[model samples]
Target: MAVTSAETARPLALVTGASSGIGYELARLFAQDGYDLLIAADQPAIVEAKQSLEGLGVQVTALQLDLSKVEAVDELYAAAAGRPIDALAANAGHGLGHAFLDQDWNDIMHVVNTNITGTIRLLYKVGAEMRTRGRGKILLTGSIAGLMPGSFQAVYNGTKAFVDSFSFALRNELKDTDVSVTVLMPGPVDTEFFERADMLDTSVGQSKDKSDPADVAKTGYEAMKRGDGDVVAGLKNKLQAAMAAVTPQTALAEMHRGMAEPGSGKN
Candidate 1:
């Protein structure tokens, strides 16, 4: 496909964690919508994905960035290089599960760095730029797990709670501006996320019946376009989130056991 004039003339979307999962799918959808793209991920697959996107006739720039480094957040903005970022999709993150205090502190901090601090910094930078330009959309990948306490996945859940909560508050803050913030809350996505998190031995990791990343990304894209504050990706997740609201934290934690510990129980 030739680059559409509509695409060639406008600022493009910048998608983080774009090598795979919902990020990759969102990048494809954004390209389809005639947006040129800047896709970044620490994984090598990001390079491959960039080449593939270029074949679709949209201009694309790729970067290998590890958000956990903290400095990478500013470096990403530097890579933007004064281009108006029409859209920002901050979808790069990982999960950390197990008894909270039993886990390595380094692992815990890395998770916090990637999911919380790095994300907030990126949001602050790009969002401020968007506000000055008076227009932009932001999609934050949160998790339905954030709705309640998570036992084995305690720290990961805490991070999502922050993201999901922060997204809504930020949306309200940006309401007067041309910027809109949307949070994509998905559960049990069929991404390589679990394996990458070293959670391949768990039940959530082993589940074959996970939601497709493409579908989840579509939901996010639609929600971001609509300027919705938060969207739970699947119906089952919506129900789960709803239930978590009324259910006690203790009960919710117990219910979350199976999904968190895939290889945990007796057959």
Candidate 2:
């Protein structure tokens, strides 16, 4: 009697990284679409974000999680016992600047843990559940940067590369099922992500002239609702994606050097 099954009339969505930026906007968009939300992010801001979603008339659950920790994935799914998630948006990600060689081991591990290990683990479990139910939608937050190379932000871009690639493969594998996987590949967004990631001083991070997270999230959600395999959020980023197809890998890395370098002003 306690659990709300997936057969319910109202859709329920679980969004990671809902504390701010694109993740926060996705929760709002889903709420407007009448989906109840289970939002998770490591930051304290999830409290405010959840309150905002509740104000939109959606049932909201917020959790503070260090998603970088491997154990957090199961805990997140367990927390959803009473709710059958119709959709899962894996939108939490972070960036780090400075030369990869010079970066702290722990910091790099933290990013890798969250972006790679943790994300894939959750996706696997959630995908399995959806497969059994024969219904569900999943969205992974990827980046246009995944197409090319990242200089100082190498690890971040590499992780996104994994996400985008993994999403495509998973989508194909589930082609026979009702479950759909969408990879939201967005360019820069005007959010506090850069500030918090400590990349605000870099050229790419300092680029305040970025896409709105709300707009980006809208594109992703709509695409997921339609079961589109992938979507690039901005026009400029779309062009970047096009170039990535033809450009040489070495050339792309060189191009990214100035942007990721410190004092480059990409925020």
Each prediction's TM-score versus the true structure: 0.94, 0.95
**Residue ranges of candidate 2 with Cα displaced over 4 Å:** 1-8
What TM-score should be assigned to candidate 1? 0.94
Please provide the root mean square deviation of candidate 1 (C-alpha atoms, Å): 3.1
Model 2, TM vs. native: 0.95
Q: Candidate 1 on 89-208: residue-level lDDT in tens?
A: 999887887778778999999889899998999999999989999999999999997898877788899999999999999999888998999999999899888876667777777777
Candidate closest to the true structure, highest lDDT: 2
Q: What's the C-alpha lDDT at position 104 in model 2?
A: 90
Give the per-residue lDDT digits (tens) of candidate 2, residues 57-156: 8678788898888788778888788566789999988787788998999999888889988898888888898999999999999999888898888999
Give one clash count per candidate, in the order shown: 3, 14
